[model samples]
Target: MMALRLRAQHRGFHSRRPSRARDVARVGRVNPPAIRVVAIAAACILGLTAATFPADEVHWTITGQNSVTVDWRGGDAEVRYGTTQALDRRVEAVAPEPLPFSSRGPFREAKITGLDQNTLYYYSIGGGPLHTFRTPPPRGGSGFTFYVQGDIGGSLDWKHVAECQALIAEGRPDFVLCVGDLTYGNSVGQHAVDTHFNDVMRWSLDAAYMPAWGNHEWDKPRSDDLRNYKGRFDLPNPQSSPADRRYPYTGGGEDWYWFDYGNVRFVAYPDPWSGAWADWAQRAEEVMAEAEDDTAITFIVTFGHRPAFSSGEHEGEPELQGFLGTLRARNPKLVLNLNGHSHDYERTYPQGGVVHVTAGTGGSNLEEESGSGCPWRGGCPEPPWSAFRAMHHVAVRLHVENDRIEGTVYCGPAGGGGSNTNDIACAQGSVIDSFTIYPYGLKPGAPKPPSEEEEEAQAKKPAPGR
Candidate 1:
């Protein structure tokens, strides 16, 4: 694996910001041209090169209970797992499947499934040192935690992203809900996409990252990034959108996927522009509606690149509005709806017993809360539906317990650069917002584990599709 290069954190030099008033004044006095020249040199130094890729760049994903999907860049990849760090067992190397429309290598996936539940497993990829992940206790068991964020990318705000990722590493969530836009200015080609994946590779140490497709993942003209997303990620996407070809500006392939982890049912929807809206909405409705009757699922968490409800400059989407309407119509007690694209943090009131949250401020330049329809700032009054909104960057931490899921939005510093996870994740300091989903219909009753026949049938049954 290539060395983890954290921008602005090189070892030879100490990087510091103007912390004092006089220092800030001195920084203000610096010429813009000098800054641009230094920035250009730094960018050129970090420019994407095939040499920067790990000989065996690897990452992991959670497909289902006791199941994980390991994807690597280099071919002829192998994985080893056992109860201990010294892996005594090995899964033979397997060839990757080629993309449907490209020549940029193949999607190498090795699935480690059918393991014991409520147990920790140690594993390694491509002869790397062993890493660890725990099979979540069967749905509704205690001690469950997860982080949610989106619009996270590399190259632009490397220091900020690194700090947030470090915070998540410390929390050690079972899995990460990466709503969408996992890459940005760094997403130039397939290799760049993989490099972007490797940027957050540290989070995969203890948590399986489950990501969705965002608009930025679609590179127009050639659409190589779309091919890269399909070729790089092996999610449990039983649903397919054939009408993806109808969208002229986007690329397509199994962007919508879902999985059950712990007591939560997670669904990842695609960017609306990529395919048929009607088809996508119907699929979303089915997923949410079906959860209403699922007693074992104590919480429902759905995410995507764009938010169905937001208060940022984007102000949310009508497509999501209709989808939420459908979900409300079905009366499923959804715990949280996670989304990105607004570049800020926002939470909606418990309208019809569902809370909608937007945590798009992951490393991207913060978008001021100018268009959330607030009448003022600092202590503004949001509309009846919007509970909280902020322009600062934040990542949402959800602590799922028996009857309630408490959430804390860890706000980052004034500007991008950050030093420690403590500042990025705490009840004080940068932490600004918090919310809770009480024992709504979803979490009230004691969980009854889904029957074996039902789980088996659903696994074999295809998700509703167009």
Candidate 2:
């Protein structure tokens, strides 16, 4: 098989950082919502080739107010950075870190500390081109935009993933959530590892990313597991890993973890394919119990690779159903749930007021809402819970704020101009689904199920208009 020497052509990098509220301290604590989103669209674009040498394989991760991790291809070099475009200060250069077993090349990492939140900074590795990333706002900031994506970086999905990456860069979210399935072809091998990183180098370097394991990452010892997943990214709250469970079974992220970005608290569960649902459930219960008094937490959100509720062809996950059901029992007013794996875009009606969203359209082939039936223990159907389902390659965008949180599902067309610039880049396709969440006085628990007699009485009652 002939390898494709990848490259994208574009001018100097562009960044539209999130505007921090003047009173960041006061804004983030509002008892209302998380992130505010204006609109959603998925305009597909291809032909993303633009960049010079040295900068080609550079990217940053684990970015917070006072810390950041930069990974670049070079012999051995320290990082130099500062607030201005010209990097005047420099961190002592260090030897290149060992690459994942299957990966090849002299890639190194530099951990830079002492940064201010909501401030824009520029840095370069070993005197390379100046790259930029904005750290998330302090604990309580009005809220900012973040992107959630999954099921990308495969042979067939390569171009689409690259395009999606381009689109992501265009948005310049404060941070991003990678919902697993980083790469498909030999996820841990040299070819797959290199391809995956290079594909996103265009945009990933501009935004901080938090990665979750997917079925493609597999279940193995933490050191050698998930191939480059662990090797690539880190989270702000790494110690909150729920999978540790006194035993700390490090197979694909301790099976679960949680972190607070700005005012939102994000809880991620283990991949259903990893066979770690038991751990995830335990963790979910623990967090919910804590949520009752955790005033620091403005929003309680959950994420994972498989969906307990989906209207696609891929089989459903009973574990997810059990996992989320636990949250419902514990925290009925759960704000949101993000998921992927069933390559399609799906939004479920608020089940007792929590939105469960499936966003597997991150460059994978779209699964049609066909009659193929989902193969879960009970089976999958367009349950009354399904609000919308579409077969379009797309990405999920969320805007967080103090009082109200909004979400938009953007679907790209089956075909469009093959370029990642101009209208194609900002192409806001029609919004297929959108939802809002309120944090203040959210019901503590699910409403008691109506009795059969009460249900009959309600049914006998006249309609709203009547």
Candidate 3:
């Protein structure tokens, strides 16, 4: 797989204002044309400089079972790698091409393929720093952990930045699954993408990061145009690529895609707020049908930026509510639905054989009504599907194994604002919510492990068919 080519010129490079009076004067004296020429020359020599995230801290996207796409802000599009941390082997990445304006910089990406499955490999970008990554397990292999969150970026008071650092240092998730609301960019531009990448670079440096479009991603000043989002991330292009469509796709570029890991198949589609409802629904139906026919797939997880069922300030999308209700009716393998946009954490009771989880607590301001269901601002009663809710910032970790999928919601420090609000305060790094789902062979309400007393009582009872 070739790395995605730079499609447009961007100004993602962070420009620092001259601080000293003399420095400012010097900069002011420089001519625009001269500055442009100098910048172009520098870019030609050193590659575009990513002021926010250094080239060494590369952003990763899992493109296939044997390949991963690594992108960096400013550097030679070169990656050297091998199975060992020594990086004895190497591969030259595609060099960055020049854009129209010399002042703007282009994001450099390289697609590394032909890697050994389930093997640990160490790589360095432009010989900057040594980083390690593990490929997805071989087909049918089932033992991995991935993190999930949404609403990352912005709201410094929310502690998302620090929270993310801790997640990587301790949890070290294999990859990240984000439900959207990625950057709180007020507009559609490089600065917005830069700010978001800066906030999450720590996680991106270590693990493959996959995201679905959220309202904040597309509902910006340049509405409906996801050039930045699409250009930055190289998602699985199952429909467009010549390879057999492993799963159904709506042919929306990175707007939607699907991939598999171990026994789980993850399908990311757009919600009504992000894309056409009918188009995405059609893809969802196709994926469900495929999963139903493939007996090897033990779990089917779908995620997006907007929630199909959420009690946060934004509430749930009414169109999604109906579509999901029907989708889950016939697809039991579609056990989990992940989403964000509510600015809180919520888990629904098994509704129509599937559990919908809203994990919008990834930084950003905490909504009083998020997960609370009371709608501190006032409205209709809480929906019956809501099982667990919390206003604290959090990131979820899912342990996907052969028989079950276990999830643990790890909470971060409470955001600013005194205790008078509806937000729940919890010790940072505490597990606020946890649950297990047996998607293959278990009764509907049979999730959540039984208590010791219940287990003991069952043991005392006679065996079945005795």
Per-prediction tally of clashes: 0, 19, 0
lDDT of 1 by residue, 123-181 (tens): 76655555676665776565577888886765323445656666666666777888776
The models' CA-based lDDT, in order, is 0.60, 0.57, 0.63
Best by lDDT: 3
Give the per-residue lDDT of model 3 (tens digit) for 1-466. Answer: 1111111111000011111121111111112256756875786687544532345324788898898887666655567777765677666555333211111444666787888877777777766666776778866567678888886663232345456546644676777887776765533223434556656766676678888876555443333234555666778743321111321222345667898777788988663432356566766777877876676677888888777777765666667777776666556677888988776788998876678898876665555633544533324455677888876677788888777888898877666543214356678788889999887336555663443345678899998898
Clashing pairs in 3: none
User: In lDDT terms, how accurate is model 1?
Assistant: 0.60
Of 2 and 3, the candidate ahead on TM-score is 3
Query: Which 10-residue span in candidate 1 carries the lowest summed lDDT?
Result: 6-15
Stretches > 4 Å off in candidate 2: 1-57, 63-65, 92-98, 154-157, 187-190, 219-225, 239-255, 273-275, 288-291, 369-381, 415-428, 440-466
Output the better candidate (1/2) by TM-score: 1
In model 3, the Cα lDDT at residue 147 comes to 84
Q: Candidate 3 local accuracy as lDDT? A: 0.63
